[model samples]
Target chain A: MRISPTDVAQVMTLLHDDPEFRFLILSDLCGVDTGSVMQVVYHLWSDATPDWLRVIVDGLPREDPRAPSVTFLWNGAEWAEREAYDMFGIIFEGNRDLRRIYMPPDYQSFPLRKDFLLADDAARSPGQGVRHMEQTFQPAEYRRTPVLRQGLGSDAGHMAPGIQTAELASGEDPAR
Target chain B: MTTEQTVRSLDDPDLFVETPGTIYDAIPPLPPRTEREAEFYTMRDGEMLINLGPQHPSTHGVLRVVLKIDGERVVDLDPVLGYLHRGVEKICENGDWHHAISNCDPLEYIAAMFSEAMPVMVAEKLLDLGVPRRAEYIRVLAWELNRISSHALFVGWLALDLGGLTPILYGFIERDEIVEMLAALTGQRLLFNYLRIGGVNGDLNHDFLSRLGDWMGNALKRIEDQQKLLNSNEIFVARTRGLGVIDRDLARRTLLSGPVLRATGIPYDVRRAHPYSVYPELEFTIPTREEGDSYARYLLHLDEIKQSIHIIDQVLHRMPDGPVMAKVPRLMRVPPGRAYVSIESPRGQYSAYGMSDGSDQPFRLRIHDPSFFNLQAVGLLMPGNLVADTMAIMASVDPIMGGVDK
Candidate 1:
């Protein structure tokens, strides 16, 4: 139940190996300040066994906010880690692909940080602007990453190594 | 009409290229475009971007997918939330105990009644205020009606998504009745604003009970009529039957609750698991279906409607009357502690978390929204289905954009 910080990859492996933990729903991840230092947290659940388990793994912040990505194990964990990255700035290593989610592609800073602020709410450029409800816009200011014309021609994102693109879609199983 | 299609000015392709957002002004009354496509083409690497909501209408709120799509099939789907975040957590952080419900209830519009009551019940536990017996019975009555109404709309929307149009109107017709019944007492229909700090804001009258009893007796037949309309229609069955299934194993693994979980054959109803109000006193079965398919989920809603009506009938029969509110200090305070109270809402298990610094206002409040858990199941069920089935799967989840994004 308790996974050591360095063996985080093993944590995901063990979860997959154990049939009981069939689906580990990565509920919410946050960085809780434990007074002197900070700890990156993970909340994983198994409905098969009906248990909500908290798998806490963290280290010094100067190093990348790295941890095992459960995207390979549970389909539900795909976005949760991305959210942790966007807000708490956690770097989930071995996650074959990673990208800015929620904020504009060129967002300057993660908004959920303890010391994060909001940028102006105005659509400055097409694709650069984060349109909420297609109403008031937030201009992606001079952020670290450059903004791209979003939703242009992109279809889908990452897939596990062995999974075929077409196979990993709905209606592939006619019986289903 | 013509052999090809109806005439309209808005459907012109040239309008999209030459005059975006100006389609409303064109005089020729083009056929309304059934689908709007806006792809943010031309991108570079290094940045991670995805679409959350545009794929499923369920995420019309702040939820967007931070997609790194290799093709139509998602290689990576990162749900970007807080875009619709109004900081309900922060607001609850700043407000007093009684003031929090004003903000919390609206977050989950589909299950607002349950959302409003769960917070107050958790606060009551912390405050050690025993609600009067009359208030207890009334709470049960109100919640039962609300649950039935919420389920009815779910029935209609699910049918609509699967291409059965008649049930939508039938379901809406039933929903309007409950809204009217709830409205007569609380004044407003949707956001009841019924729960006060110690007890409910108002108590039910005889007229509401009489109408409720009559409706409960006849509602089953009305619901069955809805079923006959589409339960076995070939296309409806084909579109929904085995698709978007979250197997029993996957459902429990994700900690999925409510009808969605029940559809997979687990009887984890919060009312049964952790009883509050007068639910423990009532006798009713937690309707569950063994198959995890969309058909199972669809059938489960009908079973739930029957269960809710049965519960409402019992509440009316046994509801004892007295003063609704229990006595409490005008300036409320509680010993410093934490209490988590969960209830079976229309969607699923909804709970409120409290950290009391022994003050009138909770130092911290975290709500475990049911839709948040249910919607996440989309990623699990969505794959392997064509783009068309996406909406059907999403509509089956019966999410509130406000609830999911919040």
Candidate 2:
């Protein structure tokens, strides 16, 4: 079932405290980043009953994503909330230690965000294509010629200055 | 520039001493607001800090816990994790259904079959597909075998942590035998990517079955021998019994699962609670103990091994001969929906939550690892216990950092 960010704490209380629901365990608390919004998913399972309840708090604003913390109800939510905060930047309100769980505390970006680019991607210049092939074939002839860089060009035989390219011990073609 | 100036500079308090108005000086002191916070902030005379591993052997893996000890008794503990995080959840979201199975293999490396089974089951549920009867039986067989190996290692590791070496050696003997059997069936011993989308990758051959039967005959007796070796030992009983006790309420509140939860007198087994695959068809009982201590948890592991063996034997008896896999498309495009599938893993309830947007890849994949939850109880179990008892408590919890950090 889907609930609003405002209703998360109350519903969690009802699910946990109410005798009928009795969802004693907070199995998982994960965050999903859609293009426009963040969805904090809570999976609750009961010890006495077989019911697995999913409480999804959808439509948290993208720029400032925040959800009410359920740590007070379930201490296990502490780490799970920290993990969500670390990965998706969804702040869990009322969580005392809302620091990063998977990433370093000083880490600036949430890697799980859809728009977050990896540090490796920042190294490439505009129009600088992929460095490695997505998938390589066994045959060398079918392989695409790698784009050479300035200061390290084809004239250098793809070797940087001061580095020598050795011939194969068999004295065969380098490609072979 | 001169020798006199150099001597003067070296002696100067201004040059030698750290400045008062630096970054460290700019921070304001925190005043405790709550009664509990006040106690934590105030350091009693005997209280001192001990940082135990992101590298300690007793910690099992790369887990660091900052423990505040009041002499021999632990006053507080703060477990620091994420040393082994590899962004597994994000990787699962980016990868296709087939890739997700292989990616999740390392989460619970001790029982690779259970870890693999969770994702496959969730994907199957999301796709609304039923596995073949033969495949379900094969999955049960593999899962039970993996559980035995995992529990065997735990038995050894727990004993080793408590300063016993022979049990771990015996544990490894059983584990190696099962792993060899698994390798013959799955090709990989440690991280077996055997479970596919709708079914398993391979069928159980005659050789594998015969060997499994061979192992089964002596497996319980061997485990019993292991129990007798440790359970009756005066030191083992003294170290484990009445130490690191977790009551039934605390166990449920902390969300401890699997054998640890069962040890607290709650017979909540996911296999029985939410029956999946061929488990519902199989006949096995959930064992519970009222002791709720380290010894009870150890006994629970032995009992569980027996129960798992029973389940596997039942699978062998009702083994069906047919196609192993249900017909699945090459590119499995799971329908837009959400599903959570959990199984009774070695440590606890290992669950996989998947959300699909009608794409070949999952929109989001969340692994609700049991170790991650069970590790939380350490905070409750550590305080007021002897400093040495911390190792015993953590061992009883039996967290796999691969699953905890992931």
Candidate 3:
């Protein structure tokens, strides 16, 4: 069932404390960036229900998504909340140790956000008229070309200008 | 200058003075990041900190715990993780639906079948696809075999960590036989990218069935031999029994699953709880122990191996015949929806949560690794125990760093 971020603590408490709907086990807690909004999804298990009860805290602002911590109900939620915070930058407000779990403490960006492009993603989907690496590659022609020799010569010149060109064993100069 | 003058120059007070800082000082001081870290780092009178592994063998993988010890007893511990973090979830979300299966394989390397099965099952849920009965049987067969191999390693490693060398050799022998059987079936040894979205990648062949037939004949005897080697060994019993005891309440509070939870007298197996695949048809018992100690957990692993073998036998007997692959499109686009599927992995409930936005690629993929949950119990269990018992407790918990860090 979908609930507001504010009702997370209240609903979870009722479900946990109420004997009628005893969702004792917090199976999973994850953060999702849905391009437009942020969501904190909680999967709870109980003897009362055969299926896992999924509680989605929907429509938290993407800029600074905040969800009430469920650590009070289950201690295992602490690490899961930390992981969510680390990957998506969604703050679990009541969690005492809400530091980064998987990333370094000084890590700047939340990697799971839609805007956070991976290092290679930029080269794969370059903007405007720029050709992507996959688009430019023709394996058959690439193999036929002496690209490695040309690249090595240019790299050597760029790296050390003082190096003299040496003659090959076949009496051919690389400078030619 | 003379030798005496040179020696005097070298020993000059001004020259001998340490510089305020150097190029090496570029690395900033990493003070405690969280409340737990700050508390653990602050040494009290007679309390010292012990940093154990990002590199220790007993840690299972790259997990480092900062143990605060007051003499021999552990005061508190702060487990520092993320050394093996590969950002698998983000990578899965970026790839196509099919790519997600292969990507999930490395999340729990030891039980790659379950890891691969998670995404496939979740995707199947999203698409409302049905797997063939034969495929379901095959999946269960593969899963049980994988479970046996994983539990074998766990049993051996736990003993090895406690300084017994023989059990691990027996463990590897059992593991190798099963792994080779899998390799024959899947065409890969470690990371078998065998599970597809609607069904399994390949069907059972002659080579795989012949190997399975041969192994099943002596599997029980071999398992018994391995168990007899360490089951009543005095040192093994003394080290493991009554060590790192987790009560029923603590196990529930921490959301512990698999053998760890089973060892706590809670007979909560995912196969029985939420019947999936061919488990509903297959007859196998969920074993439980009342003790909730390290020894109980170890015994539970052996019990589970037998149960898996029993399930495998039933699967082989009732094997159905049909096409393995379903009619999934090359570029499969799932309708906008969210699906979650959790299966009983060797260690615990390995779950995958997927969100699709009417695209080939998933919007988000969340993997709930049970090892991550089970590993947390170590912090609570280790506080009052001796420093040497740390390895024993951790080994019993059996947190694969690959899953923990992921």
Name the top lDDT candidate: 3
The reply for model 3, stretches above 4 Å from the true place, is A128-176, B1-31
Q: For model 1 chain B, where is the 10-residue window of minimal lDDT?
A: B28-37
lDDT, candidate 2, residue B290? Answer: 93
Q: Which pairs, if any, clash in model 3? A: none
User: Global lDDT for candidate 3?
Assistant: 0.83
**Candidates ranked, most accurate by DockQ first:** 3, 1, 2
For candidate 2, write residues B112-206 as lDDT tens digits: 88887767888899888989999989988999999999999998988898899899999999999999999989899899999998889999977
Model 1 Cα displacement at B175 (Å)?
Answer: 1.0
lDDT score for residue B392 of model 3: 92
lDDT of 2 at A143: 20
Q: Relative to the true structure, how large is the alpha-carbon lDDT of every model?
A: 0.64, 0.80, 0.83
How accurate locally is residue B41 in candidate 3, as Cα lDDT from 0 to 100? Answer: 41
Model 1, B239-315: lDDT tens digits are 88888888877886565778999998888787876678788899999989887888888888888888887887787
Docking class of 3: incorrect
Q: Look at candidate 3 and tell me the lDDT of residue A38.
A: 94
Question: Order the candidates by TM-score, highest first — what do you get?
Answer: 3, 2, 1
> Could you tell me every candidate's TM-score relative to the true structure?
0.71, 0.84, 0.87
Q: What value of lDDT does candidate 2 attain over all alpha carbons?
A: 0.80
Q: Which ten residues in a row have the lowest lDDT in candidate 3 chain A?
A: A142-151
Task: Give every candidate's TM-score on chain A.
Answer: 0.54, 0.66, 0.71
DockQ of each: 0.12, 0.12, 0.16
